[model samples]
Target chain A: MNRLDDDDDRPLSPEEMLRLIEEQQATTVRRLGGDPLLTHTPWGITWLAGFGALYLNYAYDLLSRSTALAVLFALMVLSMATTFFAQRTVSSQVRGEAADRGMMYGLSWMFGFACVVAICVRLSPLLPSEETGLLWSVTSMAIVSALYAAGGALWRVRTMFFLGAWLAALNVAGAIAGPTVHALLISVGAGGVFTAVGVVQWMRRRGGA
Target chain B: MTGPRELDPVIHAQARLRVVATLNTLGEANQITFPGLRELLGMTAGNLSVHLGKLEEAGYVEIVKTHRGRTPTTYVALTRQGRRAFEDYTATIRELLDLG
Candidate 1:
């Protein structure tokens, strides 16, 4: 550890002082958060494998509906757990208004999804099995897309904003294509997008972009 | 036009300057733990404490000692006055450099 000296009288050119200020600010911003890849990759994998299982189960009858749903549920749980732990690890080290904002943002996701689940539960019993599945998947995707877009806008992350827009469009397209095709579209389209975004973020970090 | 603008002495010191700059990165209502700030700045605890004292005296920083569970912790935040002073200091530096 460097001892702080009474460098108050130390002469620095204006350029040097400006550079020092910039450097300190940059370092603090970088150090305050966990890597984005930690959150993105787990979610990507969960959606890919979970939705892929659903597609196979629905299209080819390769798996039972119960088994497919179980796989999706388990993967979703795991992804949520990973995200929670990653956030907790980072938030524990920092405190303040930004942390509170982050906490509220995370809670919004839970609150939003709980509402989606409740709505789906009430509506599912009235529809046919296929429509019920479509309703649940579509509504969930819509909520997720909306949250992502909002979060992206809040944080000024362009890629996240665009990804959310893309997901919203993809969800609509899948719904239009009908039920079985909806699962297939989400399995390939949404899953692929998530994985691709995760990979791009990871590469950017590795390349120090 | 006139003689060069003077930077705030309270924020112009190298160590305190770095501290203020880092704290400024946080949101207006945010704070950093003493250990967190020290580790970020790579300063000795004694050195940081001394500098923080000086900044606190100048009303540039607010240091709050509180407990989290059974553990005691100190949090350091930049007061609004400190932020304004930093902004003024930067403006003066930029003017001196003729960077507008």
Candidate 2:
């Protein structure tokens, strides 16, 4: 630890200052860029509940489209409510520029997702009845996965990249598994994985690490 | 390029420069705890306090001491002046490097 003293007031030249600034920025980013609440327990539970609702909705689609959609809508609303509460809790503990950036990134992702969904809904009438739902789901998942990958690269977070890869692989599995099996896989397998990651992160933070 | 004399002396020292850079990287509105800053810079608490004191005296950074339950916690954030100083410093550096 170099203590700055007025007696030793040696000024850094422009080049030296620039080098020091870059060094400091790199070190700080490595230190503070990660937010533990990113995979919080509340977030994990919300993912599980939300994906479970979607699973049920998709499984029932063959029997009743309208009913399935209604369930899905209810689930979506519930997921959003839970997420809102989760964010509030996490924000109280994690207050920093990183948190602010995460919120901005989340908002952008939601906006992009909404746009993709709207476009898919508009195009669904043109597609064959047998393929419409599957096409929409795959497309949405692929887009989200790609965005996650891009974000991971930008932020240098390996977990985010793995998440993107997982989602993309799930899309492939969905294509082969059919709607019912795919829905089950999403709810029980993927949701469980997300929850487990969140739990681990929560525990680490609680342990003050 | 801004002349060396035009640069703020209060922000010209190496440790203080690093301090300003770290705060600036976090964004102008962000406030970091004293422990947080110390950890970020890998500086001793006494060393960090001295640099922060200099910055505070120059009105470049603001320090707040508050009680969390019974314990006192120190928070540090760059003032508007500090942010501007950093921006100017970076711009000057860029100009110098571009010329070279």
Candidate 3:
């Protein structure tokens, strides 16, 4: 967290420095909508890492090394973009009283998850087939989606909450019924949920001051 | 006109309140940036800088300055001593409030 070298030119005593850190921290919480959850980076980080690992596993087994590499490249690009976007939305104070960009951020992880899924589904037909690994792969994707959902809720992101709720439904249904139900979930359910959320966020942004 | 209320007196300072409470919640590095502090407090730069300077003078904060794109930025983090002081402050308040 401390990216700077210790300033030994230190005008303040060790005692004074501690005081400043405390004061700044209190202000930070207020900035984050006073949400208790945002203070803990590890909470965000755990899901972020978990999702990354799960996606890695899904992409790692690709039959064509080129495809895997391509997917990896996509991940890097999406991650950098997400970082840029999240920073822009979060750091900027809402222009008006009702403007909470937290809701808008749902599309962020949705975009992230979609990238991975699109790439994986694209590679599906290209793989060797004695072992389908279909059920486990679906389950894994479902779990990753659950994390995304839960994480979004924790972050006060309505978009993520919906994604999480839907993914949870998909996880349970898929576990019981297998890939027979995937097309419905991937197409109708996910599309419906993302569309509804995206519209709501846009409306809210327009409505805000 | 009897005794003080149960709320922690030490959290009286707003910026310190953010730092202590914020750090209290985390295990990994307890550090944040000027932008984060800005958002958390919703304060203008001058106002925060004033309070932060006071806290720095008090040894309650550790400021680390760095440059990006030729712009200098500051990172503020809580010290171990600061953490204990805040914990004690909170504990005393909790005891008074029977929150524990």
Candidate 4:
């Protein structure tokens, strides 16, 4: 028997006792809804750096391929080192769902990259080399923007949703503006938005702390 | 009123109720660390440990201990059984309230 009913001699009516329990449950549920784990801190600078590297690789076509590859390798090393340290410092319990979501997010990006590569290769046979890069850029941007937008909808995060919308708009604007302008728009416009979001989140976290 | 009769006594205890309630809020995809759970429930380490032990013994929750660099961390997740029990408990509680 529940402890609530253990008191046979209790003067309170059943309705009154039930009301109290309901009220308590409501309070508990409300408190639970406020759990901090729901909001994730966006590592804006990391993403900005990543996008900047890509833009640089495309914008400076005269740069040696080896140099571009070396820059990418350096960026990869930096990202890995930062992640290794972050895991040790961050103190959250990752559940299976969060882990699964992360895995899916990574897979989506990889798949998007692969699709862009395959499309570029196919288009190269039909189009001039000069047009191929621009086509690839626009398609890749659209894919990433759509993926982010889809993720935002699934996660119900307003910031993520807005970022996705912004990226899509940038991609459209880039298409009309030409290759150099498109690269700059992605590297600065979209990248700036992500960085700003991260900065604001960092400031809020510091303030709260 | 006979509250929904399926309430698991192991889960109905006041402190454990809060713990389970909090975990349930995360929607099965996330676990809670020992410190996170303790702070959320406002319980001391010893008290929380005892309640967690009971839940673990009942096979309702799975506890994992891992090392993050030099520090040892403990994570707790509700097992499928535990989730079902929690659901049943809430349904019963709702039934009891509605009986009025």
Candidate 5:
């Protein structure tokens, strides 16, 4: 690599300099913003497979309850781990206020879920076994949707906010419809939402939108 | 306040201006990899190194060399002095344009 002469001194007009600054800043943002598809697709698969198994176990008894629970637990854990590491990978690439914000946002998810667990454990003994399961699923979904909504609002992403709203509605309908139907609703409905959103984001990025 | 303020000579050049502008987007404590900044500015490594050396000399940017595993990596960050200089430069520009 050859170093060029350092004697070149040219002045830019104020308007031109401002324009250049704006253009370069925009380029930096575009280059550093991580792909949404990577974050969403794995989650889509996890929800689809996890809830599908739960539906099978509850509705058709195709798998034992313990087996279904284990599968769901494993998939959820895997999805969470994938999301955590994916975020860390992106954060590792750049350092700024955005990185700190991302860390806080990630921690917020853990905090939200912890509160859900605490609430559920406290409420579990009052409900029957079957209702306890229903309570756990509904509360968990509620927390997820609420967090998504909060995240969307924080990030100013309209699609994420709408997705959270849609999922919240689905949670209500599932709760009213009972556990078996709730499992099926989340399996197809929420899962489909995740998959569809991932595809749309992928397409948008490919199109340079 | 009486005479027109001049832009910082170090940041007045086109390439150096763009470099400072790009680095300005980063958080105060945040650092970007050498290749990362180079890619952002679309500048060759040698050219960027030259400009960065000037900035470092002026206390505008800090460059650190550290090992990431077995690979040596170069990270660059804007310093408080540099950020203040850039801010002043922009304010001066805006003042010149009568927008400030």
Candidate 6:
């Protein structure tokens, strides 16, 4: 602990301020590290399941197939909470000023952008009815995921960038990948990729230690 | 004729100052949690609980509790009175600093 950690001492450096901010962004994820998404990898993709499950509901509801939208919504919230948990866990484990204040939150912005797209698609009837709700939901997830990856990349978390890029690629590949495959890619491929990344990162972290 | 000034910890001390600044990062414009305040301040649980208790006593902060599943999360916020006190404190501090 330097003078910066000294409570009774003088002010902190600008670098110190940035470090504090970084740790806070990842607080919850760290506090709740058991989340599936927070796996040992930087790009664990299991988080995409929330969107994949949501997509199934959209497909079902299309035949005017009404099920438990509320339940699904609840699950979505749970998934987000878990994701935040994983993020916070990772942040907490991060040492030094650089790790504490990594640029992870920007990923949520991508989600915001995706949400906007989902809303637009929902209102416009551009996508198939069955795909409508899921479309909106997944689009939003994609946006957020992409941004988070971007943030991870910015923070030099190569795994984060790898995961984010994979999602952006998924969106591009969606047309060819189609819905069922797209969903699987996100849920399985993407998720597996992320988990792998987390594992590898963790290994490296351990090896370094 | 005006009265005597106020006392607000959210506006003072290195610790409370860090707490509010960190909360601002959440951007919800809503409340913060006890664990969150503790994390933001990077203080031990008991130490933070003590500072928060003092702030609450001074009418500078308020705490609300809720549960997510079995875990109880405590939400904290600056009261209107607390915010006013903090604002007043900031102004006085600025004035004092300016005098220096």
Local distance difference test scores for all models = 0.82, 0.68, 0.49, 0.64, 0.80, 0.53
By TM-score: ranked, best first: 1, 5, 4, 2, 3, 6
Pick by DockQ: 2 or 6, better one: 2
Clashes of 2: 0
Model 3 chain A scores worst on lDDT over the 10 consecutive residues at A1-10
What lDDT is reached at residue A186 by model 2? 55
Pick the winner on lDDT between candidates 2 and 4: 2
lDDT string, candidate 2, A86-121, tens digits: 555443333456568668876877887888789888
Per-residue lDDT of model 3, residues B7-96, tens digit only? 333344544455456645332344556776565555567666766675667676677887656887677776676667677665554454
The residue pairs in collision within model 2 are none
Regions more than 4 Å wrong, model 2? A1-13, A35-169, A172-209, B1-5
Runs off by more than 4 Å, candidate 3: A1-84, A87-143, A146-180, A187-209, B1-10, B23-28
| Segments in model 1 whose C-alpha atoms lie over 4 Å from true places | A1-16, A30-34, A202-209, B1-3, B13-15, B39-47
| Candidate 1 residue-wise lDDT, A16-41, digit = tens | 88999998886776566555666767
Model 4 chain B: ten consecutive residues of lowest lDDT = B1-10
**Candidate 2, residues B1-100: lDDT per residue as tens digits?**
2563366777777778889998887775677778778877777889888888889998999888877678877778889988998888788777767766
Predictions ranked by lDDT, top down?
Answer: 1, 5, 2, 4, 6, 3
Chain A TM-score, cand. 6: 0.54
Docking quality tier of model 1? medium
- Each prediction's total of clashing residue pairs, residues at least 3 apart in sequence or on different chains, is 0, 0, 34, 0, 0, 28
lDDT-wise, the better of 2 and 3 is 2
Q: What lDDT does model 5 reach?
A: 0.80
In order of DockQ, best first, we have 1, 5, 2, 4, 3, 6
Among all candidates shown, the one with the greatest TM-score:
1
lDDT of 3 at A198: 49
The TM-score obtained by model 5 is 0.69
Query: What overall lDDT, based on C-alpha atoms, would model 2 receive against the true structure?
Result: 0.68
